[model samples]
Target chain A: MKKLILSTAALALVAGFASADVVRMGTEGAYAPWNFVNDAGEIDGFERELGDELCKRANLTCEWVKNDWDSIIPNLVSGNYDTIIAGMSVTAERDEVIDFTQAYTPPDPSAFAALDAGLDVEGGVIAAQAATIQAAFIAEKGWTLIEFATPEETVAAVRNGEADAVLADKSFLDTVVGSDGLVLLERTEMIGGGVGMGVRESDQELRATFDAAIQSMKDDGTLNTLIAKWEVSSQW
Target chain B: MFSYCTDPEALEGLAWLSCYLTTGKHMGLYISVVTVLVLLAITAPVALAFGFAGATAARSKFLPLRWLGKGYTSIVRGVPDIAFFMFFVIALDQGFEWLRHQVKCPDWPDAIRQGNDFVVCTAAKLPLSASPQWLHETYAFFLAVLTFAIVFGAFAANVLFGAMRAVPRPQLETAEAYGMTRRQTFWRILVPQMWVYALPGLSNLWMVLIKATPLLFLLGVEDIVYWARELGGTKNARFTDYPHGDWRMWYFFALLVFYLSFTKVSEVVLERIMKRLTHGQATSGGEAQRRANA
Candidate 1:
């Protein structure tokens, strides 16, 4: 038992001093702008490319894996993935369990889209998934809110004109909202907390490297171009 | 420190209630219940009907037709049911368009099934592109119902065909001797007498059908499973009037109760049916009935 404990302590000490090398990244392959697998079976999108760039800048070898939106976090917690580059909105609730890097993409809460062209939804209030700061923003705006199984359904409701608009992340709005005739109509008055690069709580060194990666990407003007690529129809 | 609870700190009565009810996902959770019932309600009858036809065809005098029915029942039974559910719907939808493609969009030259993708003209799209969200949902449900019916029907057919043959050949022959035609004897003797034997198999089929309702979520029906996940997902306290932690376990527990209640109700109905079917027949159930109540 003494030897086992000593070996474990030695391993921990080694891990602490060892350079950050290989990192496993998690992503929900559903959302288009963030990360989605295309017809050619290649993961393509802003998040996908950005993660590669971040790894390169951080001097780390990276591996990407697709997971369902629901299982993404549990898998991360279970040590399946070291980082999540999925457009995961960092909330205080999430921070309690897992730490996040500095904001890579600013919050732009979702806007409404409608089936009817002249539906006059400019000032109508809305609701998004509960527990989200978006829900609080909804109450502040005094809008009726609805939750759906997927963003696809929420957008479907807007397309069906069930609600005046959907409240969601700006990046989500960019990916989900269509241009046929629907429009954002309005943006929330205050900016909600933005999405950030996620890492396991113990991976502070990795998080620091990710923060540096973000700064490098921003300086190179590559981040702006990547944002432009994903932001097909920006809400903000 | 806040545990996974739907209701935490309360501000007021109505305010708390409103927050509790409108946590946003409640509506979808509620709708999923209807979707499951609707899928089951339609699919069960269609499956039963298809099973009846398939069983009859398997017993038919025509060699090729009998082989087709036999092949359908056996081949489907061997494969994973979910695969049939996934592939059959897409195949069936494309099959519908292929028929329509041959007639409607014949001039447009493109192979309908290209490798893994099936593409038809925009005009040939099932439930036309301009249809509403509810219509898309309905169309998807229609496809699911068809898929469930086709798959479950095959199983039911195998059960029913055995039950049909289990009816005494002597009884059928006696009916024929009485100057009754084959159709008349089938209805008057074979169909009536086959019930006692078929009841056991059919009751088992009914239980399976009830359990299979969860598969609707896999088909994108947004049923109870979808709602449970959506509503159960944790929301950050940073954004809501009434914030809570992950309550997915409780949501799943509620779903378990719903399914159990559904199963209990079906069991009662099937029991009642079994009693009714056993009345005044040559079988042991009928014989016991005569001795007990006579």
Candidate 2:
């Protein structure tokens, strides 16, 4: 048993180092259609497929690292990963911390999910995941905002009547709405710039590499294909 | 960071892993291990003091003091520790904010709990929204430690109360015969002799405390278990440098070893302390030592 374990460790270590010119991509695996852990316990969804194609086009060996959404950019900046492809939308506040490549997906509409279709979303208590654009939007509108750590909890808050509605990315809420008596409200808030790959400010060369790949993907319509297949944001 | 680590793409194998393991997030994991140790060190003593106070108060001559002490232990101990943790941190944070809100925003028109949202004035926010991330994390750690101390302190009190009572009544009578005051009997006699009885229970509590460190994650402290799950999930070539299939089993296995080794060390240390406490006392442990010495 000991020998078998040692041999496995040795093989894994050797296999791990075989790839040179590697790019580490960071994502939050909990967000579906954007990036999520599939039934096989492997990361799947729109960003995952797009990231893989981008890495292949860039001729860089890449690996995925799942990080919490709350710390995704910080982890990227601190060298835990080489890039953030975690469905993160471009924003001025985030730009101050790290650079973003050309957007792969267009600005996704933020929608409200509530128990009642006629719920007063504008003035009612709102739920959003902390540190998200939706959360910021709610706070900006001066609505009563209750924040949870994860997206699921935001939905749970609305279901349990802790909040009147949960505001989230339409791509995320599309699969969630219509179940558990959740109805999508009519009001849609288009917030944030298009979703893009995030890189550390110092990684200019890496950013340029990904930007070229993303541009190529956009020109050839492969990015739009993946976006449509995953039913994420509208085509570029 | 090593010299070759400057270009992560050029690195392979052990070199790649060396850099990967030394990343800032990994360093956070390493530091959080220290956080657990620090929590245990601080909490054990604080909880013991609380437990001592509680046990002593339960034996108090004053009626209200005794009731207060017993009530504290019963109420805290009756609720599940997880439920207590979830309730206490929010309650304590809101309690502090509410107090500050009353003082800071006395003229403010809005009620704090508007519907389900607990909105304290910006000035009254705990650690403030604009405070640095480390300050927020530190405040959370402080709350976690306080909650752990309160919960474990109650259990410790129960053990200590029984231990105090178990000290022979004749021993107190004998102290009285020697003209020792009630205070002196408790301090010089009852307190001193109770430990030989208490050490076994306290040692068990120590093990439980070590096991309970993982609960820090639930309180949003990002403890060792949190790091394990974060780092060990499946990573394909699409997202990170070190791509692997679901390696959570391995990461959790490493945690298992860490906890076992830690508990083993605690057991050895507790055994030594037990020996020291039992010395010359009229107990089975002291009798065993006397026979071995003879």
Candidate 3:
């Protein structure tokens, strides 16, 4: 029995580093501010900066990979990438497939940045993709509306004056509205978002290392400086 | 699942209810099927109209008009359909606005093309800058329809042009020999008989049109394929009232069944239409019809 326990512990030690210091992280380069690709072809978003800091603190070398927006979760579960640092929210459906680190960023009030006219999310029926917090908020408002396949379409709707405003991520709210002459009209109580790290179920040790790195960044003001540089936090 | 379903106390029952309501995405699933149907209903007629015009133009005596028709038909078959689907809608949208820009904002100094971006005057926006919600969706749906029609119309024109050519040379000669004008021969002898040849090709186009409807999702139209993937997945506990596991695969399976059944039903209906169109004509199909009936 003692031998079996030691073997199990050894196996656990091996499993912990499944995605060790040389971490392969995935981000949606299309989502601006959070993790969008700039004209220079480098991933230069808030999450990318934060991801770098976390890796630095963890003493891990990192390789960044660009992927399609929707495939992030599937790739994570299948071990295609070590972790997803995209501006993804923690939701019930995602919990089943993979584990997420505690939210590093709190969700800010979601609003649509309309290119055409000023938008008031309070009066308009909430329109967000289903299963998201935005969708839940719209449901809470007791309004019915359409859901789009991507943030790009949602933004296009506002630009075309198709939707009043898109219920969307905060970092995107700034980039889209700033670039397109859109304005955010409201704010909601912030919700916690899964904007930290992701690891496979077997990589509990890897997850712990990420959690420790995040904590260290917060302790050393690396997180704050990065946040200030990227302008990711609205309230910062 | 049923016994446990009402038990807020029992996780198993709650799981069932969660699955039931969240799987309500099935409603979205069915809506996409209608999207495919709507795409077909609109595209078929628009394509037929485009094809008929193209075929007519190709056979025209005038130089530019015939070239225009032949050009339209040839363009469709050469490039990939996806390329056309992507290019035409944007190109046509810009084409409309560019015309409008010249007319509406002619005094504006800025060039519309600045490197990579397209910037037109606010007044020149398609559907205008001040249109309502329904107008936008309708506008998108209409653009999608136009794209589908323009692409499929070329294929239809190919079928139609061949049908026109298949009419016997003697038939046209007889009309001319009997002192009929070219116009008279075309109308009296050629046009009506062409349908007997065209039905087989037209029927095939209809089946292809059905197959192409799923592409609506790619065009940003929230058709059935969009809804199926959205609604068919399993919900987890982080979500209350609709907690289930990943079920997207099963939902897509149902969609496959729906599409298969729809295609089977169409084949039977199209076969019947072919017989009706070919009946009592002088072509082989028509002769075969008469002999079989006799």
Candidate 4:
């Protein structure tokens, strides 16, 4: 009986370790530069490349899962995936729900893009992605904020005249404003801390593995190279 | 579309417009229309089969079967369908994972529902964690179809149940007088006659099913509505070869025309079907046709 129980316990341990080998990386796959789905319908962006490198360095097999921005964190916490590398910035409110690794990219300034110049930033309708730091910042500023599910819809709201302007990460708006008929507002505000990988609070061991990988990248300047290559904000 | 279209920026007028319409993302939009059609084709028959089962159960001599059928039909009638659509997809997904977790990981100790989070064991993950992108999409599409069928199947059941009752009591009595068994009467006499009565309600249900295809976007299937919003929105020069202003209104207009034409064709086809089903029947439609022929 003792031998049978011992063998069964050992088998269970092996099975547990086997299941832990593959880490699922959740991403919005809609945010450009940070992450977005390519024309061929695969997750392709800066984060995609960075996440792959982090998985390699950590010696963990990683797979990507595209989730909507609104449910990304909840899905991460709910065990839909193992980690969130979806350009999510570290915030106190979010930290309360889920834990984060070291910041992968430095804090990027948020800018407002509008069709017309000089719209009232205080009272006019401003669009932002729902549950984002920019959306919370706009709400704190007492602006009439219209929240959208994705970043593209926020820009669409500005162009469709539903909102006067849209506030999002500057790198995101830069591509939008460079196009015709839309211009970035002079007013830009930096909100939230640097972006980080989110892991469930229960998964501290997985978080430590990624944090070490991120720290090594930061130490060796490889992180900064990726930041520059992706045309994101300043280096760490 | 034109020979000079090689120079996108240099080309002016219709040439530029023609080339712009043929962008890769625009091809996705075209494919989405087929997605909607495929969904309708699959769901309609599945829902009809479900409705047939539910209606048959409702008319069964057994008490428990009748209550089960009644419960299925009436429960869905009480709530808005969009609410049902949103609720069932998540509920069913979690439900499946939970069932798998119980069987696959008997030794795992954590509670599956931790506060608002649903934490199933890694081994129990639906579609498995290592499944390809296409499998993930196919899984979501499968969930969307199941949700659509269940909700619409209840509505179809209600219509079919009422149609069964409308199949003239005397026709069933005639079957009984001819020494037919109850099951034989149901199959031979009642089933054929119910369709004539059910045709109008089913056609209306078919129209509702078409309009509800847009709800697939809510399930994250990237249907035509999603593609339209993505491609028709302002495309900056940095992101695309063909930059354009906000042309969402035009794209939506195109969707509007497509649905209208689809419904028009469906209406004509359904009318012809109704005529065929009503032929030689005791309905007003059959009587009018007979009078016209005389």
Candidate 5:
């Protein structure tokens, strides 16, 4: 039985497949302006545009993979995709597991949006998307934090009264605050260095390829143009 | 893809919608419906087998076996299915990787668990890092099926155990009186008659199992609920090709219709099976069937 089990596992291991040459770019399609699926049901947004350009510059064939935000990092680590071009922040904690290319977008302000202007954010229930920089910041402050699976849910939490306020990147909240009767809190916390592509630590070569592509985009002012067009964050 | 789908931005009306529904991501949503059904098909029988073993063990003459069976049913059934799903998937995944770590990287120097991370050698990664995307999806799906089987198996065992006992004591006595052994009596008389009693409980479990298929998203499988949420979300024109307002309500309504139709079909099939099982049995259903036939 032991031999049989081992042999079956070995057989499964040996059946390694797929085109190693095609770099799969994983993104959370729910996050708008950063990365989202358009009406044509195609991945669109700053990251999609930026990722395509980067892949082009790097001379790599790339495909998009839409993944839920909660498992994005783990999926990238598990080799479900070659890179996470999602609006992932560059943080020391995440750097322990995955290597990141240099920042493509400047450090975006993390703002709190509440139903009312003067809501006490410190004491009240705050919402943040799970596994995000804002969520970590909220947890570290020992504030009551309600974490949701998607960015939209965090905003919805504030609207539906499940949370007193939702803390997220200003780029994301800017679209929600004015339209949904959500008022941006005066308080803004700049948490991450910047948003960048995440690659597995072992893929230093792939990391280098993207890093170079990003650097070229930055140098030519094209990165800033895309960031300005999308209004994702502060331009370089 | 329709011919007009070639220029999605220009198209409007049903033609646009026809193209929109046929997009690659939408196809993923459609395929995920199959994923849910496939999960149901595989999990039901596996759960039944597990339940049979557990119920048999619960009634075992050996004290230890009875304790093991009872413990399996009670402990698993006591925990919420969601909690079990979240905990068990991670644990089982780590368990597999740990086993591989032991065999493949026995000489590794670093601790496996560091702070919040579960680090194993790259060689020990389940499905291996270089493996295909389908392999990753299949592995996650496999883990989900196992998790569902284990959790639902406990519920099934509870139902089957009650059903087994509900089989009349005199039926087993009759078998023993006819020179049959305890084992023979169980298989020949008790087992056959328990189905009529078990069907109602099992059918309820079947519905619960169907509802529980959406929890596959929590296990990282891109099942129907995930796609519904992803697709039905509002899209901005600045970011997407086919930007639209929130259509989650409509998408979820479609899911509601699908699940209702699915359960309706299941109810019809289960009713037929129950009728078949009740035929000539010493029960109210059996008696009714005989009377109707006469």
Candidate 6:
């Protein structure tokens, strides 16, 4: 019985090694245009479509998992999911933690959205998503930065008067400013490197697969088409 | 919603308001209230059962059992409830995955915990990475429930232990005099009598549990608070049919009313239960009732 149990366990271990084909893609499904959860409770939006296309092109079976933005990178390293297809900007600070594919979308200006234009952008309380380039920029400028876990919360902070303004991607604020008693400030500055898919540093082969897939899309103009369709950022 | 709600921006006043409330995201917010209620409904009885076992174990003649129950009740008391909720969920999740890893992959070589990363083999992944969306959600919800039950169970056990002791010794003596066995005496006398003493603490715990439901956001469960934040955020004209300003305060106010009414309803029910349990008992409430009747 002991020998049979040992052999059975060995077989199971072998079976476990054989089923490693599927790549789990994690995204903060709360971010719209980039990625968001639809009314049907499925992951929808730009990255969802792009991720599926990339997966098909790369010939890798992929599944999407929704995770909170704050812990997304940590969870990736911890093996919760294999790749982060969230709207994560390639940054030197983030590069220390995980590897990134080539830019899927080029760097876009991060704009300030406020109730009115005149609020002192430098001195006034500003909200940004935690761990984003905007938050780092705000901190460097010596402004009071109230960081939130998700991008939406940063905008919510501005709307609720918790902050004077919010600094986020222009593409995201473009959808928010006109109707929500908010107006985008004129002095938008480009921040961070282009957005890319993040993978664990150990997963070089997986990173190469996605890197090639992104390159193919870029070459065929499909990447630019999706960017325009989603109105994500300024096209590459 | 009116038929004219098809053109939301064109509609104004009460018509627009009605249409706004019936939006799909608003419906998600409404359903989240059911989620909180379901969590409470499932957790309360499970916590109570855990509490009963803990209290029984604490009172046992066996030293190890007594220590275990004592440790369970006291250890959680020192940590803040939120801290316990946050810590226990991750710990329990990792614990389950590690056990599964050991069983499923005997020959797999790497240490499961390498620095900060929990490197489990793919097959050991809880809910197994290949499971459906519902299974993933169900697994997360199940973990949340267990974490809640474990934390609240300790508090419930503390209340029950005191309640068990508060049961008069003479009542047990009377049962013994009637030729009852120890188990029979405990069931017929002690357990029945302990309820009246336990009611106040248990009701307070229920209220705490209700308030703590908001922490489900931390657990990554989209509870009412999450929905309130999501749906109440500024939705510009480009994003939604019923574009709104920061209406989070209003959504939160609605949640406030929901919780207040829920607590009010709970208070009335608990009062009736207390009255029922106190009836014809040796307590002051029972004595007052007897005097009033006489």
| Backbone atom clashes (below 3 Å) for every candidate | 8, 10, 8, 0, 4, 0
Cα lDDT tens digits, model 6, B53-73, are 899999999999999999999
Tens digits of per-residue lDDT for model 2, B21-93: 8866577679889999998988899789889999999889999999988998899999998888766766876
For residues B8-88, write the lDDT of model 1, one tens digit per residue.
464567656555665444665667677778777877777878788888889989999899889989987898978776556
Q: Can you write out model 6's per-residue Cα lDDT over A100-156, one digit (the tens) per residue?
A: 999999988899999988777877899999988999998888889899987878887
On residues A28-113, what C-alpha lDDT tens digit does candidate 1 reach at each position?
65455566554233566778888998888887777666555644565455444578877777887778867899877766545545
| Index of the highest-TM-score prediction | 6
Q: Judged by DockQ cut-offs, is candidate 1 incorrect, acceptable, medium or high? A: incorrect
- Per-candidate fnat, comma-separated: 0.00, 0.00, 0.00, 0.25, 0.22, 0.22
Using DockQ as the yardstick, the better of models 2 and 4 is: 4
State the weakest 10-residue window (summed lDDT) of model 4 chain B. B127-136
lDDT measured at residue A176 in model 6 versus the true structure, 0 to 100: 81
Model 5 alpha-carbon drift over 4 Å, by segment: A1-14, A17-26, A38-44, A48-67, A71-85, A90-102, A110-147, A155-167, A173-192, A197-222, B107-109
- Candidates 4 and 6 compared: the better one by DockQ is 6
Angstrom error of the Cα, residue B176, model 1: value is 1.9
- By summed lDDT, which 10 consecutive residues of candidate 4 chain A come out lowest? A1-10
- In model 6, which runs have C-alpha deviations exceeding 4 angstroms? A1-22, A39-41, A116-119, A159-161, B1-24, B114-116
Clashing pairs in 2: A17-B13, A21-B9, A24-B240, A25-B239, A25-B240, A63-B239, A63-B240, A64-B239, A64-B240, A65-B239
Top-down TM-score ranking? 6, 4, 5, 2, 1, 3
What DockQ was computed for model 1? 0.02
Q: What is the per-residue lDDT of model 3 for residues A77-195, given as tens digits with 9 covering 90 to 100? A: 44335688887777665666677787676555565565445545667644565445676767666765667655555665665566676777766666555544667665543554546
Top lDDT prediction, candidate number: 5
DockQ of each two-chain model? 0.02, 0.03, 0.02, 0.22, 0.29, 0.27
lDDT, candidate 5, A1-236, per-residue tens: 23324544764657433334678788888887788776555788889999999989988888787787877887676555678998999999999988899999988789999989998888899999999999999999999999999887787778779999999999887766665577899989978999989987777789999989999999999999999998899989
